[model samples]
Target: MIGSSHAVGTDAGKSVENTFTLDYQVSGVSQGTITNDSAYTGGAGDPSPVIDPAGPTNFTVDRMIDLAVTADNSGLVVPSNAQDRILQYTITNLGNDHQAYSFSIADVAGDDFDATGLEITYSRAATDLNGDGDTLDACEAEIVDAPLTATVPGTAAGSASYTCDIPADLPFTVELSGDIPDTLADSNIDNLVLVAETRNPNAWAVEAVAPSVGGVTANDADGTNTITGLAENVFADGTGTSEEADKDGRMSAQSSFVVTSPDLVAEKRVWVLRTESDGTACAGEAVPAVEPTTEYPTPGACVLYTIEVTNTAENAGSDAENIDVSDILPENVAFVSATTSGFNIPGTLTFKKADNTTNCDGTAGETCTVALTGAGLAAEVGTTDATAQLYIRAIVR
Candidate 1:
C-alpha cells in the first residue's frame, strides 16, 4: 500500500543570519542491467543498484526580521519644572519580515536638566491624507493613542512615571548600555515607501516584491508595542528594498523631553566705601559694600543695587535667550546711574538692536527705575559672549 515516489517538507522557524545543508540516499533492487558473460565462474549478483548524488549542498533562507529607530523632539522648548512635555518618536521596521523589539528611551544625566520623573509611552501616527507621505503628512502632531499593547503599564490609562532600568547612582560620564537609541528601524514606513517609489533595489537590494507594498502600515507594530512584531514579506528581485537585520540594518525610534527655565536673583544694598580706619570688618575686602537688609541706608546715603540673573543649564544643543528683568526702587531713592559688568557687556553699551541703536531711559523715582531692555539681557551660552553671568549695578540717589 505504498508508492515509489515521495516528498518531504521541513519548517525552519524565523529567518536569521545562517545557512543550512541537506543530504539523502535511495537504494532498491537493480533494474538497469546484469552483465555476466560467464567467462569466469561468475559472482554473487545482488541486483540492487544504489545511487546517492553529491550532497551536503548549501541552502540559503532569506526570511528576515529587522528593526530600526528614530528620535524627534521638534525643537520644543521645555522649561524647567514644566509638565506634560510630550516628545514624539517613530519606530520603523526595515526588515522584510515581521519583528519584535524591546523598545526603550532612558534619560541621561549631566545636561544640567535632570530627567526627573522621566516617563515613556508610544503611539501610532495618524493617517496621511496628502497620499504622498506617511504620518507627518496627515497628523504630525503628538496624536498619541494607546499602543497595540501598553508596555509602560499604567501610562496607557493616565500619565504615569516610567520605570528606568538604569540606576540613579550611575555617573554621568559613564555611557551605560541603556542609551537613547538602543534598537533597529521600524514602522516609520516613509523610508521604504519612498525607496519603493523609485522601485529600484539598491546595490544591496536582494528580493522580488518589496514589503513596502503594505504602504504606510507595511510594518504594523504588533504585540505590546513595547516591542515590534513585524509581518514577514519578501521583496522583488532587483526591485527589493528589503534590508538585512543582523547586518546593522535593524530599526528603532527614540525621543526625549527637555526642561529649561531662567533663574533671576536680585540683591539691593548701599555701596559704602571704607578706608583703612573705617572698620576691621571692611578692611579685609577692597571693594565698597553694604550690609544686606530691608532698609539699609538713610535717605542721604548712596544705595547700590545689584541684579544677578542666570538660567538653569538648558538642554544640550539649546539656546537660552530673550530674558528681561525689571525692578522698582524704594520711594526714598532716586535713580542716578547704571552699568554692566565686563563679564557680560565688556565693550561700551551700544544698546544695539535690530537695525537700530538706542539707550535705556528712566529715573529712580519712576516705576521702571532700573530695567534691562532689548537683546542685551540674554543667558547666552554659545552666542556672542562666553559668560552666562550678566551683572548690572544701579546706584540710586
Candidate 2:
C-alpha cells in the first residue's frame, strides 16, 4: 500500500512508521510487445513511482525508547521505632516499546538513626492514581499509600524491631502487564517501604530508587532484533545526545521520619476530701480537696491525691517499660481509706476502676503510699489519646 507505515505488532491503520512498500508493472501491449516496469516508495500517503527494471525504495522501521522516574513526597509522615515507613514513587516509560524494570535503593541521608538497619522492601505494581498514562504528571492524585502492601510474594507486610545492619543492600524486579499499547501506556509505580525497630529519637528522611543499571534487548517474531546498543539512557529519536534525556530510569523519594522514644510525664493534683472537727467524713461523697490553707492538713481536713501518667510518643516495637507512680504520704499525714482506680496493685489487690475507697497502708501515723509496677499499670500510656494516658488516686491523713 502506498503512503502507509507500519510498526512491529501494530495494526494496519495504527503504526506511524514509513515502512510499507508497493511494487507493480504495466502489462498492456506496447509497440506489439508487452513492457512492464514500475515500483514505488512512500509512507503515510506519499508514494513515489520508480522506473523498474530499476528498483523499489527500501524501507526501515524506526524504533524508539525513553524512560523517566520520580518519587512522591506529599503529606508523608512516619514515627521512629515504627515497624515500616512506606515511601511512594512513580515510574514512567516514555518509549514506544513495553518494558520490565529492575530496582535498587540509595540511602540519601545517613546518620545514627538511618534506615540502613531496617528491612527495606519494594512493593508490587501499584494502581496508577493518575490513570492509563505513561507519566505521573499526566494524572492528579496523591500517590501516598499502597492499597495492599503485597509486592514480593511470600513477604508478609509490616515493619518490626530494627535489627537489620546499616548499608542495606537490596535488589528487586517487576514486569509490567497488558499487551496493547493503549493498555500498556500507563504509569508503573512502587511502594518502597522501610521497616526498623530502633532509631535515634530524632527526625530525618530516607530515599530509594530503581536505576537502569543495564541496556535494553529484545527479538521480533519476524526473526530479527530491531533494537541494539540502546543503553540504559536511550532516545528512539536519534541517540538523545545528552545523558539526562536518556537516563537509565532511576527514581528515588524521601519521607519524614521521627523516632519518638516513649516519654513519661505526670500531673499531680490535690483536693480536700472532707472536713471533720477532729477526723474524716463518709466516703460516699467528699469535697474536692482545697490547696492546704495551712502548712498541712488540719485536724479534720484530709487530701485526695490524683496522679496521672502519660506516655508522649507512639510506640509499636519498643514500648515504655516499668511505668510506676508512687507518693510516700506525709510523715504525719497518716494512712486513711484510699481508693485506687485503673491500676492493678500487687498482692491480690482488688483491681477496681472507681469507688473502691480503701487505704493502701494500714499504719496510722507512718508514711502511707500507693505503688504499682510495670505489669500492674493498667492501660499504660501510648501516643493515641486512647492509649496515651492512665491515672490513680489516694487519700491520706
Candidate 3:
C-alpha cells in the first residue's frame, strides 16, 4: 500500500513497480517472512496466501509535457520603418516525449511603441539560404504554419527521410517577424515577448486544451482512478516571467527593439584652384585635395571648396531627408557655380543673395546652397558607406 511520485529521470512509458513483505513473530519468537507476490522464492511461508497477482506490481510512466524558451539575441537591433524585422528564439522540449509548439508575439506594456504585422516562422530545412546571417529572406525558413511540429531525434543523418527529421530533446529555432513604426528616434525602446504553448505531437492540438472547449480533459476519463498500467499526460510547463502560468502547457521569453537614428557629419575644406604661374584655375592640377593653406590665393583666382557630408550613423532607421547645405560667401569672395558628386539622389545647387532671401545667379555677394529632397542622403547601413560631396567654385574678389 506504499506509493511515491514518479522520478524525474525515469523514461516515459517505463515500468515502476512496488511490492510489500510481512514478517510475523509468535509470542516474541521470530516466525517466517511472506512476500506479496509468488515470484519471491526466498520466503519460507506459503507465497499463494499473500500473492496479490501472478507478477509484481507495475505501471508505465505517463508523459510529462514541458518546455523552455530563450531569446537568441538579447537585444535585437531594429531599424524604424523597417518591415519584417526578425527576432529569433530557441524553444527546447524539456519533457520526456516529443511535442509541437504554437508561437505568438505580444507587445509588452510600458514600452515605447508596438510592432505591427507580427508573424512567426521557422525553418528545419534551408535555413538562411541568402547567407545574410539571418533567415529573413523569402526563400529561407518558409514554414509559417502555427503549431510547428517537432520530430523525435532519430538515428538518421539527414532530414530527407521521415525518421531523420526526428529532433528528440533538440531545440527548434523560431522567428518572430514584425514591422517597426516610422519616426522613432534613436535609442527608443520597445519591449516584446514571444510565447510558446505545448501541443500534442500527433493530434496537432493544444496539450492543455480545456474540456469545455471540446478538448481532452487532463488525466483521461478515469481521472484520479488512473490505471497504473497505461501511460497518461501530465502538464509540467513552468510559469514564465511574461505572464505564463505554471503547468498550463505554455512558456514565454522576452526580447526588445531599440529604435536607431541617422547621425550625419559634414566636413568641408577649401583650396585655390589655380596654376601657381597664372590666376586661371585648372581642373586637373588644383583639385580639392591640394588646398592652398601655406600660400593664399591671388586676386581673381577661383577658390574651390569641397564639402563632404557623411552619414556616420550605424543601424539608422531611415535615410537623411529634406537636407539642405549652405555656405555664406565672404565680402572678399564672389559666389561661383556649384556642383555635386557621390550623391545617390538628385539635388539642386543654387546661389542666393547675401540677404539669404532670394535666389541669385552665380555673382558677387551671394551664398552657395544645395537642396536635396525625396530620399536625400542614404544612411550608413550594413557594408555600404554613405557620403555625398559638394563642390563650390568661388572667385577671390
Candidate 4:
C-alpha cells in the first residue's frame, strides 16, 4: 500500500533492489557463509547450487501526482458596479509526496458576463485580536496579493505565475478577486474556474526570470523511458467538473458570482369614461373605474391606461440606464393619444407607435414604445427618486 499512509521513499521510475545472505551447516559443522548474488555462480571459493542464481531482485517505483480544487462555499452574491469581490476556494494535494503547484484563473464560457480585473490571491485564517466573536475589526488578517505574469500555464524556465508550497495531504486556501461590470441586471451569474498545475519540484527554489516553452520542462517524468534508480514525475490528476483534462498535471474547480441589484417594477392600470354615439366624451370617474367582472366598457368608451416604471430600493447600489418599454393595444381598441411624466433633467421620455410616428391615427392593434434615453433611471436611494409614468388614451371600437 504505497499511498499517503506509507509513501514511497524513492522517486517514480526509480529502482528498488533487495538481496539475501545465508550461513547454515550441512549436518553438524558450519558450511561457511554464502551471500546471494544473481551474477555469481560458484566461482573459485564461492560455493552454491551452481545450477541457478539466487536473489538480488529489484523493481521500479512509479510516481503519482494529483491534486484537487474545491469551492469553499456557495456562490458569492455581489452588487452591481462593485469592486474587489472575493471568492474563496481550497486546493488539496492528493499525491504521495510533497508537490509545488502553479495556479491561474479563467472566465468560463456560457455565462452571463465576464468579470473584470481578475486576480489571484492567498487567504489566511481570520484572527480576532480584539476579543470579538467575528474578525470584522482592523486586527483581522488581510489577503496576500500574488502578482500575475503575462504567460499563464508556463512562466520562465524556473519560475511560475503563482506558486504554492504544498505538502502531501494538505489543503491551502486561495482567493480570487474581481470587479463587477456596471449596469448588470439582478440574478445574473458569472462563473470562474481556478486551475492548478503541478510544477517541477526542483524549480521550487531560486525561480529565474527567463521565458520557457512549457511548464514542468525540466526533469519531467517520462512514462515511456522510465529508467530504474532515477525517480521521475507522472501526472495522475483526474478530470474535474470545470472541464479540466485528465493526466495533464492540472486540476480545476469553479465558483460563481450572482448579481444582487435593485428591482425595477413596471405596472399598468386602466380606467373607462362613458361617451356619446358621436364619440364625444361624457362625464366619467377620474380614477380607474371599470373593474373586471363588475362593469364592462361599452362601445366608443374612452379607456385611459397608466404604466408606471418604479426603481425599487430592494438592493443597494443598483442604478439602471437605457430603459425601454413597449405596450401593444389589443383587438377592437383604437389608439388615441399617449404622454409621459416624471422624466426630466438629462433624462427624456418619448412615446411612439409601431410606425415610429407620434400619432397613431386611431389604429387598432398598434404598439406604443415608451423609451427613456440620455440619462437613465436611478433608484430611490437617499434623496433621489427615479420613476417614470406612461399614460395612454384608447377607445373601444
Best by lDDT: 4
Q: Candidate 1 lDDT, tens digit per residue, 165-239?
A: 111111111000111211112221111110111111111122233333212222213322222122222322122
**Candidates sorted by lDDT, descending order?**
4, 3, 2, 1
| lDDT at position 293, candidate 4 | 46
What stretches of model 2 exceed 4 Å from their correct place?
1-63, 109-112, 116-397
Please give the TM-score that candidate 1 achieves against the real structure.
Answer: 0.25
Clashes of each: 50, 18, 7, 1
Off by over 4 Å in 3: 1-8, 18-52, 124-168, 203-227, 262-397
lDDT (CA) per prediction: 0.31, 0.33, 0.59, 0.60
lDDT of 3 at 136: 64
Q: Write the per-residue lDDT of candidate 2 for residues 249-326, one digit (tens) a residue.
A: 323333333333443446677665545423234344443434545434455455556665544335343344566555
Q: What is the lDDT of candidate 4?
A: 0.60
Question: Candidate 4, which segments miss by more than 4 Å at Cα?
Answer: 1-17, 21-56, 123-145, 151-160, 203-214, 217-222, 225-227, 261-397
The digit string of per-residue lDDT tens for model 4 on 1-397 reads 1122423244344456776656677776656456555554444664443222546667666556788888875477765666677788888777655455667766778889888877777644443423456766432333234444542322322244544334455567877788788778878999987777776442211122222323452334344745554445566778876455778777878899888766455778886654422233422234453443444577877777788776644344556676676677765677666666665434655556677767456656666555545645667654333687777766788
Give the winner by lDDT: 1 or 3. 3
Please identify which of the two predictions, 1 or 4, would achieve the higher lDDT against the true structure: 4
Model 1 misplacement above 4 A: 1-61, 74-76, 100-102, 109-113, 125-144, 147-258, 262-397
Backbone-clash count (model 2):
18
* Candidate 3 TM-score over all chains jointly: 0.47
Please give the RMSD to the true structure for each candidate, in Å. Answer: 25.7, 24.9, 21.1, 21.1
